[model samples]
Target: MSKRVARIGIFIALAMIFSYIEVLIPFSFGIPGVKLGVANIVVVTGLYMLKPQEVFFISILRILLIGLLFGNVMTLSYSLAGGILSFVVMYIFKKLGSFSIIGVSAAGGVFHNLGQIIVAAFILKNEKILYYFPVLIIAGVVTGILIGFVSDKVIKTLKIQDFSENLK
Candidate 1:
């Protein structure tokens, strides 16, 4: 395989490992389901370094890997909705705006939760699910911003621009 493809694989594997780690660090905010999204570091790094299409591929692959390992087949719908929405939001920001890495990452976090809420609404077939929208959106906004800030710090401290440039 090409060096570039190998790099992609390595990052994907790293993403999976990070994701599993997130799963284990359970401090659920007592909200049934919420997280700090540390695993998003990989996604943010990939987006900053790779093209839009490549980022999309990484997002889907990571989601699939996580779902298959710990999630049921029925959960694919949630992953699909969340992953696609998150990618679209981040890609739009990166392509059309002047937001830094953290900004895009934050937006992706919000978008991911929005997507999952949507999936939940559809799956449960209940309009009451709309009630959770506000809470989840709040969670998304806060978590997104936090992770974005963290990613920003990581990028600056780690000199990620060099790697990003090479990957591109």
Candidate 2:
């Protein structure tokens, strides 16, 4: 296999590991569907380091693999909804080229939660689930910022841009 393919495989593995780690951690904040978004560190890194399409590929692959490994049909559905929406939002922000990584990631995080909430509302058939929006927004911002900072550090320390060039 080519080095590029190998690198992508490595990234996917890292994302899956992160997802498993997040599951292992009991980080309930008294609100359902709130998470620290640890796997997003890989997603954000890919957004900056890989092609847009490649990033989407990695994100979707990770979500599906995680769902199969650790979740059921409902988990897969919710994850798919949140992951797709988050990826779109982040891609748009990245294309705009105005927002810093933190800003883009923050928006992505917020929208990710929003997407999941929307799915939950539809699944439950209750508008009351929307009440979680405000709290989720705050959680998203916090987790997004955290993920962004970590991604930034990883990008800089690893020289991801330079490495990406080598991969190509």
Candidate 3:
């Protein structure tokens, strides 16, 4: 149990590190609210390496930590929505067991954007934001594929499955 808790701590730290890196790099799509979501690589990896609930805990905790450190209340709202929605979609796809990690990541990315869009629409009280949905979807799929590929490699290279089995 201590080992698992320690590992979860590590995962949260890694996720925060990735988020910090994203802030430093600021790889934008030349559009507002479009980000590479590099932190999600850790989330994606956790989905495969840890239990769904553990992964969920890590993702949410990371978002809260990062938001508190670097973002405002609005950013937190958007992130919470995106993180929750993306986690749900990723979890469903992972449970389906037919989708590749890439596919699951892609779904997660797209849904993450969708969640943010929903929040934006609600907060802005304007439906015009929906017009940006298509672009976000594209960006999401592209980033998701890249993040997924990286996650897949990380999992295999680290033999995370083998390591996590011991946690069980």
lDDT of 2 at 140: 89
Against the hidden reference, what TM-scores do the models get?
0.90, 0.94, 0.95
- Winner on lDDT between 1 and 2 is 2
Question: Would you list the clashing residue pairs of candidate 3?
Answer: none
- The TM-score leader among the candidates is 3
Order of quality (TM-score): 3, 2, 1
| lDDT accuracy of residue 80 in candidate 3 | 96
Q: Which lDDT tens digits does candidate 1 get at residues 1-168?
A: 386788778778988888898778864677876877677777786776666787788888988999999888767778779889988999899887798776787789888999988888888999898788888888888888887777777666656457655554
Output the worst ten-in-a-row residue range by lDDT, candidate 2: 159-168
Highest lDDT: which candidate?
3
Q: What is candidate 2's local distance difference test score? A: 0.89
Candidate 2 C-alpha lDDT tens digits along 1-168: 487688889889999999999889945667777888889999999998888888899999999999999999988888999999999999999899999999889988998998888998999899998988899999989888988899889888678457756656
Per-model C-alpha lDDT, please? Answer: 0.80, 0.89, 0.93
Compared with the true structure, model 3 gives a TM-score of: 0.95
Give a tens-digit lDDT track for model 3, residues 62-162. Answer: 99999999999999999999999999999999989999999999999999999999998999999999999999999999889999999999989778457
Instruction: Compute the lDDT for candidate 1.
Output: 0.80
TM-score of 2: 0.94
